[model samples]
Target: MPYDTERFDGDILFGHNSLQVVYFYSIENIIRGWAQHFRHDASKKSFYHVDTAIFEKLWRWARRRHRNKRWQWVKKKYFPKGNGRSWSFSGEVEGKRVYLFRAGNVPIKRHIKIRAAANPFDPEWELYFEERLVYKVKETLDRQWQRWRLWKEQKGNCPVCQQKMNPETDWNIHHIVWRSKGGKNTMDNCVLLHANCHRQVHAKKMTVLKPCPV
Candidate 1:
């Protein structure tokens, strides 16, 4: 998603994780534009939800020339899942696998984010959403969700102080059973703690409430 790389690739828009897109592009245009695009070196493992139409076209074209089984060699390698009706585009390009991701597949109410920007009157309204807003919103939500889940696992209280814990403040994932005593690195064996509380527990100044299931 870095704009500084002189972004391009057919109708494909490049985004995070070396991505590409082919929204509303004909197969011919997609291929030609991608081949001629600048900054070709930056994209290597293009992992994203690619247009399925591209795969459909290739399948049809190959079916005309070779046996169906033979043409499916690459497909089989990439999409070993059942039925192989994948909603993504992934394949090797000059010994490198390129991926394309579709924004529509985002399950977290993709429509809300989409329609919020799809103002037909001013098409570029979405682009004018201040600076780095999309990244900020996504990151904030993910962090909040992570913090809440951690607090919930601690049964809503700090074991050492036996008081309600706050997920909003600085916290640490402390091991309920110390790793040195052969504890497994897992949620069941872990507890969330305030940063100060964690430090005191590790410093052996405060004893943690042990056998505090979950």
Candidate 2:
């Protein structure tokens, strides 16, 4: 007697790929399993089967239109690139012709590193992960201030005036505000002056020279 295989329907058990025919308790479980297997392992040639009869009917209808279109699109857009050869769907629902690279060639470890560095707050991390670069620079006058600390200790006076002034009482940070009112926070914009010289610069009682912009 020839064993007749009826087309799948909502509640029928159908054997696939010579496997044991088992009734699935729910269609949802079968569909979910198909999605997971497809994402993780299905490639240019791999696919899975749904034993539930209703799903099989729906799958056949879908295969004629949407599935076939998607398979064609995948071949063009998302196909893996390496050799000159191209891959296409074999249309088999089980253990189809598929290509698998060696485990070492896969970028699983690099993907792990990317996931680790990802910032949770960034929405882009939900798509892909990468790192940001940052740099910091210090101004020259700030460096000079540290070098002048020894001079203040020895002379206790403004370098220009040579008048005996207390280090704590006279030394002040000055900004040579520009004629265009462009004040900079750089060391060149600053000068160590005695309190009187500092007041003179601000009060404009003496010549107010604009410091060169660094």
Candidate 3:
């Protein structure tokens, strides 16, 4: 793809993870968009009446980086005068017809942020939609505190086994009510349990296990 730095901002860089806002379009949609804008039969050819000016601009930009003699030779061979309408070679090379149009890029502001905090345990990433809150997740949590909260909510141990679990990898934060059963993403509707217990909750095979703490 051709890079058009003139269309985007100097401060904002384009592509993934950059603080730039750009509308991404597929090549197909780009062709359609250009045809609509220029009022041309996009299916007819690789180059149209409007392509000469755009290609001329592109050639000027390209000549700065390429050898003048080679560039002129290539230009003369491919970009001849008065033959702009039948310039398409997509069918010969790609086994299909292709359409394209003159397009430009524009810059946008960053909506996501990642930062470090004094509490290394807290989540450091944030995402915004139109400057509004979306959601945030902590990469790690204080297991004792998390367990205490779950204990208070479920009254101790795995509700399926009434057995205490190792606080770290063995446990999982589980929804108290099935999500499909109208459970909400709130603390009151969630509890911590052994991973096995969580699976049993889903499998509905907890009958042989001890009942939850009363």
TM-score of each: 0.34, 0.23, 0.29
Q: Which stretches of candidate 3 lie over 4 Å from their true place?
A: 1-147, 152-156, 205-214
Better of 2 and 3 by TM-score: 3
lDDT of 2 by residue, 83-202 (tens): 334531123226443322221122211111344666634533321211111001112233555326533443454544657666445345544543224455454554456656655554
Give candidate 2's total backbone clashes: 4
Per-candidate clashes come to: 9, 4, 2
- List residue ranges in candidate 2 displaced over 4 A: 1-160, 178-180, 208-214
Model 1, range 1-214, lDDT digits (tens) per residue? Answer: 2222122233332222232222323333444444334223323223122334445444443344345466467456533333233533554556665444332223232123545545423423322331123234334555455446657766777766667876565556565655545555465665666667766676663445543454
TM-score of 1: 0.34
As for candidate 1, its clashing pairs are 1-15, 12-21, 46-99, 48-100, 48-101, 49-100, 49-101, 49-102, 50-100
After superposition of all CA atoms, the RMSD between model 3 and the true structure is 17.8
lDDT of each: 0.45, 0.37, 0.40
Candidate 3 residue-wise lDDT, 1-214, digit = tens: 2223343222222222321122122322443445444332223233333344444543453344345568555454434333244432111123423322333221112234533332322221111110121111222243345456666656556766778665444555555554444555466666666667666655562322323446
lDDT of 2 at 40: 38
Please list the Cα RMSD from the true structure of every candidate, rounded to 1 decimal place.
17.1, 24.4, 17.8
Give the range of the ten consecutive residues with the poorest summed lDDT in model 3. Answer: 125-134
